[model samples]
Target: ESNRIESINQSIQKKQGVAGCHYFSESVISPNFNVRITLNPDRERKCSRAVLRLAQQFPGDAGAMAPFFLNYLLIAPGESFFMAANEPHAYVAGEIIECMACSDNVVRAGLTPKFKDVNNLVDMLTYSMGGPNIDGGAYSMDNADVIRYSPPCPEFEVMILTVEPGKQSTFKNPGVPVIMIILEGSGAFDGKLCRPGRSYYWPANTDDLIFTVDSSKRGALKVAMAHKNLHLDRPTAINREDFGGASSSNHLNYPTSPRLPYMGLGGGSTPVNEDRRILSVGSKDYAEQGLPSL
Candidate 1:
């Protein structure tokens, strides 16, 4: 692996206008070698092909390249992947609906012009080898209509909810703010219209939110919801069984909680219960009102 990396670096350095030893360390090496390559379809395609060719030539050395050494996964619509922190990965193609933590502490290794924190990335990785483990980090809820993608962290949880046409689903709030996006068909969220290309945010402690797909819609109404896991006071047996047992720090034992609901396309209605208060970005006096931001 080191030999292949060294050879690739040397070749990059010898290129007339390239200034860096690494292929993706400088823009001149391939003009589109920087981080921008991840966003440009043409550049990404060329880079993927180049990486595949290199991998084929030196199969033994390909492991060291980490993420970029592998070919892209052609993820079809409705299918998705979970990427945790410190995991080396890159998105090569297609549109995706990403639901992640609010923080932006990403550590990039290559395929971008962004700062490559090589040492930090190396120190943070789990170093597990082999192809992508699709089943390693995923778990499903008892309700077949919902699937939870729980990463080994207590701060966030992602759930995919499917409401069949003419059917409905109810979610009890987990007492945390939530962000949701509609992925397929049309539905009524808490009696409000929801459709593709739209997102909604619901404040913490909102009452049970109901969702019903329009019977006229051709397929089920699919939505991706993300929120913090605030109800981890106890761990379940299933949580302990995941990832070959819970981590020493208990990061993997995220206790199941009632899923939260995010507002959809239409004006949010105030909870009829006079005691319950909901705050949103659209609140009339949001700027002047003194409410803790989620």
Candidate 2:
């Protein structure tokens, strides 16, 4: 404990300078006074005093230092990372395409002037400390024209579609709602001219959506698509006798059939061709129109 406190004090001294340390020492001397010290963001390196304070407060929580275990990820174009729920992560820099479930609940630990819910974050974390799995592998379908990123979560799956210039590709909708974003080159989506920065949300069972890259375009058409993983096949029942007994409670039961309505948007009994009055407007207008009212 003493060694750990010394190590923290040394880091604080190096980052906070003499005046900050003096202020901290004086605050420590006062029983009624709160130790409110801010480190110089420009000078501070390695650990933060705020993080040390959090660690000191919750010595039993191994997840308190989970942020420190983070490894820098240099994600190039067309690369991606999948972060599960309750996984601790922070983007130090750079911008990339991000697809995530619609949830506003955020528990920040540090690296922000906002409220730091350390206790809540520690309690919610997975507590697994290590660099992330950076393998950029995906299942390829249709002669490598389509790449699917099937994360373990049943919520969503991402698909990358590539169409060479003057060529076309057809993707059979998996009977689920989907959203597509054009990443590069120009293309026609179901006969609509779409270029980079264009996005579309298709209702469930859109069936045989086609993408044709314009021959006039110089590069291959790249698009990132996301949709619910509702069509995944699973076994109906488990033969428990092979493992132990049929009456055992540990026997697994997978879904025998596809779900009636998909889990995400447009999951109702709405017909796919019902002309849901889908609008193809600019992003600025879409934002003004709000969330589809569907």
Candidate 3:
């Protein structure tokens, strides 16, 4: 016990500590509303949604932003470098469906106050180049219904979906799990309906899910999706485990923080979990190591 206390004291002894640390999937990321933004475009602006932050290991203080938010962000499909890091990011006023490595370790700099370790936050962040800059607006698809954007990250990918009234879109998860967010009009999946503000998750091991738009209006459905892809050689399960129902109708009730083993103030330091069977890739037994399948 004396040794442990000494170590803890050493860890926080300096105003600015170590030069660096890496993020692993072992961390936990609890959801917290760091800030809020409202848009009013009618008076030169309309009502826009509130911005929310997601990170791997959020130090949860004001100083954390100095290192993490110091960089800019740009997201696209197939292009997914930002998601791989443990920096705190905001989903500014737009609904996007996101699915990741089944880990939530956020190291924040300008968001919450869960763990205000400024020294680690500054050291762990990547001061290199900013985020991915692929714009789907540059490409014109003649055959594909969905416009896929490739950011640069390998752990995740995104798709911008546009469906007309009475029409539908189909995607096969293969094994990787998927998350969908409604960006425009109303739509329904399986049987549950979603509008401009709702979100849903399809378990990693699930099969292809169907999305249908309301036939009452033209272009009634627009959705953005974030999903895991097959990049690493490791095998993962494709079983569709329900995220289960919300503990409360409020989004605040869900667990947004990543789990343990990856809990810390810094970001992008955890190792990939050998037991991750949440998102299926190619093989039936796609474990990083060989663990009993979930």
Candidate 4:
């Protein structure tokens, strides 16, 4: 969790910017809120009751009293929630397909057994009173049975495809790489059977990837994918140095992780560096704002 929190700290401190999304597979209660009140000696105990009962006010197990002063979000099935870099959010319940930039710069304040960095999480949060409107994030395509999630950050984009029986979905790579996974139903991709829970990765500009569901099947094929944002007008050629730097911390999510610029993803693990370096950049401000003149 330190590594996760460190990345978030770096982002909030302007060392790097990171963003992420959660595509719910099942209903759940998660963290996606901001402190609703000013903190004082007794105020923390008298804030909202949601997080108190949901996490605290019971025993030492639920979590902490901090969430009570923050706004909570309820994400339903088929909902994809986007969280920008440096935002304070926590997962409460339910299942979700979470995808973020290839970075673990996160800060975990409370809500889990993992080590909690109260000061860091508190200092990192924006403390904005309200959050995104229901329509703030997410959209779908009219022609194709697909929903695409394009968050505000520059790292990545996501797409959900629902391919009905006998129908096929064709994906043409304009120029970036793509990582895909089968979420439900059986289908054919690149002439091979694609089953649920299986993952597939295709380097940038690979032969047009195609998938189809047979007419005999009763269920439609559902697939979730993430790739470099296709909306940018940048050149196709990728410069390794553009990756900024490497991550010294790694977890199960991507395991060896984003050190792609330094080593092939699956290559032998490299020793973790204590002082990972990157070019200087300002903190992420979703409001199109930057730091006030210093």
Candidate 5:
């Protein structure tokens, strides 16, 4: 934690830690919001969306200048970055695979007809001047194919797994529950065709899984997974049988904080495709992992 973060949290520890990560699938034309954005519109606004504009579309709120101070960046396909709590950002354009904690307590800075708590928002923002680097985004784990993105909050982390066509890759379970989505290409998972936009659930401590990317796709198969932050930064392959097979009853390193609304807050310009897909896990699994029921 940096002094800046500590200072921000000190004002309100568990108040509104809203953070997330994004993996760009298409080369963004403009405004990949934060990667967060805030009050300052220091430079010329390059991108304008149907929702927000420095010219006119901005709501008459106090911070309406942005649709201005809010930061914007262009991201190439396959690049990603983390958005810490309180950082202001918006994806003004392009499609992105975002993995964020499911929280209803989002503080919209602007670009929406919804409530804009500009006063509270002003207090929480880091106001860290300058735009972020597009090149310096998510990092690779022990497996280069897996682009690892673990944000500051403990709510969740994300993984982008890519496999080339006709090439087989094996991925071992990390002894934790994970929800996956196929971003591109095609494959088979237990008789189900895993193709773009398809999702799956993998149980904890499952056996080594193998994938053979379909040759007909002519492109790499990409999958994005949202899983518990199981202290897996540089993860290595693991076999469940070798550990004697008691994969359940796992707990986190620290006492789980109250899964309240986001510590920091952000919302998209348009409300339609807000990626608010929340899948319900079984109560039995929650009990085993010390997780609360959704």
Candidate 6:
């Protein structure tokens, strides 16, 4: 965790200009070892919770998990541990999809990024380790290349559309924002082409989202998407909304994740990218707001 947190510190403090304090001391490194990554301001910072990633109250406190409406992070085959809002994840080797509230309030117990407040993170994280995996029960799409993976989170859900070469999947969902992360082969979000490492955020109230693979590559064009369940008018209808609204009639009421195992490589694993260092980007604001920043 120290190494992981060190990487994040480098990125935020050194790489990016976000973190104001210079946390390059040995005490910060030693105490943060093996702790999950979750950093929030001590109420002295200036920011709104709607736009912030409040890591202070993480998985430990389910009541505090709502404000994070950050990006749907995609950790490729060799990508390092995702930071900020996303936490308690499940990704083992292959590509995976992760979507959560927009805020960067991540609650970590173990994984990467060693924060000084491990006790605080553990106190805020969700005690019950949900499932072992990300989205569960992915069905075959019209195109064999695409498969959708959905996790069972009420506030947000993820859909991984794995597309093969020359194949495309059309999603007609309106009013909700969608984030796409290209994992495997090269593809496009809506119409813009995205490489493996690129991440794109589609604005809310959109009516359509289309993903396509070049069809030249042999692997599937893995696309991970995160969006609000606007199609679901009621709580009981969650199991019935799938593959955009056009195909809602055939939506399967299958129970998603929160029951699967937390899949991912164990600690002391090999770090993937050397050029892109990880850093503790701090927590998103956790203050009160009026509008829903989904």
lDDT string, candidate 4, 1-294, tens digits: 985585555445421111111121112223332232233233333323443453333234223333332233333345444444555444433445666655535445434445545445445544322222221223453436776655444567667778999999887654777778888899998999999899988787669778899999999898877776664343221222232233322210111123111100111111111112111111111111010000
lDDT of 3 by residue, 216-275 (tens): 866557676666544323212111121222222111121122221111123222222221
Candidate 4 lDDT for residue 205:
62
| Per-residue C-alpha lDDT of model 5 across residues 1-294, encoded as one tens digit per residue | 685575444334312321111111113312443322333232222222311342244423222233223333334455444444555555544466666667565666545667756555656555433223222134454566776555444556677778898776767787888988887788765556688877888999888667777777688888877887654453221111122211111110111122211111122342211223221111111111111100
Please give the lDDT score for candidate 5.
0.44
What would the TM-scores of all predictions be? Answer: 0.53, 0.55, 0.43, 0.57, 0.58, 0.41
Model 1, TM vs. native? 0.53
Q: Local distance difference test, per candidate?
A: 0.43, 0.44, 0.38, 0.44, 0.44, 0.34
| lDDT (Cα, 0-100) at 143 in candidate 4 | 30
Q: Choose 4 or 5, whichever is better by lDDT.
A: 5
The TM-score, computed over Cα atoms with residue i paired to residue i, of candidate 3 is 0.43
lDDT for model 3, please.
0.38
3 or 5, greater by lDDT: 5
Q: Compute the lDDT for candidate 1.
A: 0.43
Ranking by TM-score: 5, 4, 2, 1, 3, 6
RMSD after CA superposition, every candidate: 15.9, 17.1, 16.8, 15.4, 15.3, 17.4
- What's the residue-level lDDT of 245 in candidate 2? 15
Stretches of candidate 2 off by over 4 Å are 1-67, 230-294
Worst ten in a row by lDDT for model 6: 285-294
Error at 122, model 2, angstroms: 2.6
